[model samples]
Target chain A: MTSRRIESFVGHGALILGALIALYPFVSIVRHALGPAAGSNAAGPFTLENFTRAWVGGGFSHSLVSSAIVAVGVVVVTGAIASLAGYAMAMLDVPWRGAIMGVLLIGLVLPAEARIVPLYDMFEGWGLLNTYWAIILPQIASSFSLSTMWMTTYYSALPKELTESAAVDGANSWKAFTRIVFPLGSSALATLSCLIFLYTWNEFLLALVLLPQNPAVQTAPLSLSFFAGAERNTQPEVIAAAAVLVALPVVIAYAFLQRRFIQGLTEGAVKG
Target chain B: MSLGHRDVAAPEKRRVAGRALRSRPATRRAHRLRTTAWLYLLPGFAFYGAFSLWPLIETFQYSFYKWDGITAAKWVGLKNYIKIFTSEDALSTFAHAFTFILFYAAIPVVVGLVIVGVMTRVRIRLLGLLRTVLFIPQILAMVVVAVAWRWIYAESGPINAALEAIGLDSWTRAWLGDFKTALPAVGLIGTWVMYGLCMVLFIGGSQKIPRDLYEAAKLDGAGPFQEFMAVTLPGLRGEISVALILTVTAALRNFDIVWNTTSGGPGNATLIPSYLIFEGAFVTRQVGYAAAASVVLTTLILLLTGGIQALLRQRK
Candidate 1:
């Protein structure tokens, strides 16, 4: 009994220690963000001045909204497309399932770097360069592969009887999907939506390449990168504040949907 | 196009067997089913095909040519591929990427295993909350992570301040700045970001392992270490493979972290192929060379991940 108690004590100790290490950087950054800047006349240890300064100085007013637009667009479109495809693959006897699955598997393994150059040229040719479409479209494509795979995995596990009964009740495939499978898969959809939202929200490479000319369409991270590069040495606090602002939306979303986010991540890992 | 039609028709024809003229309504239903399935796939395939698949093919084609983004192309078969192998800078990017695999994948797996090993022996409270907090880092923008870590590793950053307070002043230096420490410092950031994912994955996978195995091992007089080896390690194979695939890919495709933190600098110390491709294609106008590097990098990623999947093929 004593040995068991010691083991439990050590286990909790190790977890607490690991948690502290995991959270230390975020805590330090947040503290730095709150503290008064160099040579600033703030009566207290904390100030909102850094956030205000970072917000205006970093142009996050434009970038954050821009990121939101792109993320929402990608999430909605990718979700719709993936659910349809996943439903078809899982329920209907889709011809060429193997081939389409092959392409998606390739997309899963294929890094973004492979397609960025040609995508840039294609977008340029289509006169969509520096537009939200440029960023949103490619991201949808990339996210769709995983989203379809995820939804397919989800729908496959669902009992066939759900659709079989609907078919006997004179429902076509589309009706069966809309009325039954789609609603039934809400948890999986929520999981996928959160995953897609996070992926699109935090994306940097595509925005970096595609929207180089247009600061209006530039993402929060891109703007923050430029902000941090310029002000990193002079004012670390403000940069910290800017970093927080850039990370705020996803952080908020994660805080609220913590269970779904973790479920999507871990479940995706196991099943991927 | 015709293959799908023939496939659907073939099955229907077989069901009728001797009937040369099938029921028109039944034939129509099969056609409708095929059309619906294709329709469901079309929207996704259109975007995926145009943006992802077509560009992928074009990337391979572009690798064999010499052309700026504006100028007319010139065929330069294998020249760019040759450069990736021959150039000192190009070769080193791959080496640096592999070094990151150690920090990102191998170390994290070991750390995760150790943590699981400890936790398996005892039930800890707030496992859910702990997992949520640990996982926040993985979900954050890499740029945010890099910026935050850059501060943490700064000259007057907390790390140095703590080191000084502990009377280790000589040990403190710019972690991301020095050549010797730069790669490992950057790599350790990968470790910090990835180990939680490994732990979370391992934890989730561990729960699915039947408790009977552990109890059986204990009944057979196995110690904690022995029981873990005999039961837990083997049980988490699928999770470990997944963690490896994800982290190793993240390490190799590590552009965002490098871009925000070092820009592959202090004189090219932390350069990886993804960063090299971006710089080469967009910044330096080595479009073909960039394409070649990406092709090689993608091939390496597929080979490594596929190899992991094959080696760790999960038993039914």
Candidate 2:
């Protein structure tokens, strides 16, 4: 018993150390954002000046709203498309199921880095560059495969008898889907929405390339990058404050919905 | 005799009526079902084709030409591909990406295994909190991570302060700015972001293993290390493959972290393929060259992931 107690003690000690290492950067960022500049004494004299400075200088007020717009657009677009396709594949008698599945699987593996250059030219040709459409359109496309696959799996797992019974009540295919299949998949939709929100929120490269000269349209992360580089020398506190602001919403959302997020993320991993 | 004749004739008429009524609705329902399915797929396919599939084909076609974003194009053929292979900077960048596989893939898997092995035996509390804390990195924007780490590695940053306090002040410098340590410093950040994922995957995998196997190992006088080798490692093969594919891809296609931190700077010490491709297309006006590099990078990613999947399948 004594030996077992010692072993548990050592294990907890190691775990606590690991947790500290994981959280140290966040702690440092919080401290720097609240305290004086680095060269000052380690103790008191904290201020909220950094948050105000970052809000104005970093242009996060505009960019955060922009990020929100892009994220919401991507989630709504992806959710609607994925659910429809998933229903067709899972619940309906769709021809060429193998071919459609093949295409989506290929899309799943194709990286965004591979296609960003051509996408830029295409958007330029269509007069869509520097617009929210440029970001939202590609984000919806890239995110489609995963969301579709996730919804397909989810709808497939549900009892088919529910939809089948709905069909016998004089409902057309569309009505059956809208009334029965859609409402039953609400939890799955929530999970997919959370995942899409996270991806679109944290996206950087597309936002950087598409909105290069326009801070008005730039997403929060991209704006933060430019803001940090431009103000690194003079405003360490402001940089930390801006970092917190950029990360805060996502962090809060994750805190509330982490169980769903984890389950959704690991769903593909387990199934594959 | 009259009643029997009437019964037979009426039954035949009823059967004919039923067949006529059923056939029309059945065929119509089949046709409607097909149309509905196609309608459901139409919007997804349209967007995917326009944005993803079409541009993917365009990327390949663009690699064969020497067109700038403007003006008429010249046919470059294999010249860009040759440059990607022959250029010193390009060659070193590819090598640097492969080196990252160590920190991003191998180290994370090993660390995850060790942590899981301990947790299996000791049953630590606050597992949920530990997982959430560790996964914080994976959720944050890479740009935020890069900025935060840059501060942490600054000259008067916390790292140096700690070193001075411990009386090892000579060892501290701007970690990301140094030519020697920049790539590894960047790679360590990848390590931190990735190990949590690996650990999460392994924990899930380990839980699926039967408890009896561990009991049998203990009944045979197997120690903790022996039991882990006999039961835990084999149980985790699937998770390890997944962790490898995800982390290796992240390491190779790592642009955001590298871009925000060093921009492949300090004299190209931390240069990787994605950054190179971006610079080639935008900075140098070498559209064909950049497209070719992208093609190669994509092929490399597919090959590595495919190989990992195949390797794991063979062992099974």
Best by lDDT: 1
Error of 1 at A231 (Å): 1.8
Looking at candidate 1, what TM-score does chain B attain?
Answer: 0.91
Model 1: pairs clashing at backbone N, Cα or C within 3 Å: none
Q: Which runs of model 2 end up more than 4 angstroms from their true locations?
A: A1-7, A37-44, A268-272, B1-28, B313-316
lDDT of each: 0.88, 0.84
**Alpha-carbon lDDT of model 2:** 0.84
The best candidate in terms of DockQ: 1
* lDDT, model 1, position B137: 84
Give the alpha carbon lDDT tens digit for every residue of B47-73 in model 2.
899888987788788888886767887
lDDT of 2 by residue, A146-216 (tens): 88888899988887567656666667778877888899999999988988899899998888888888888
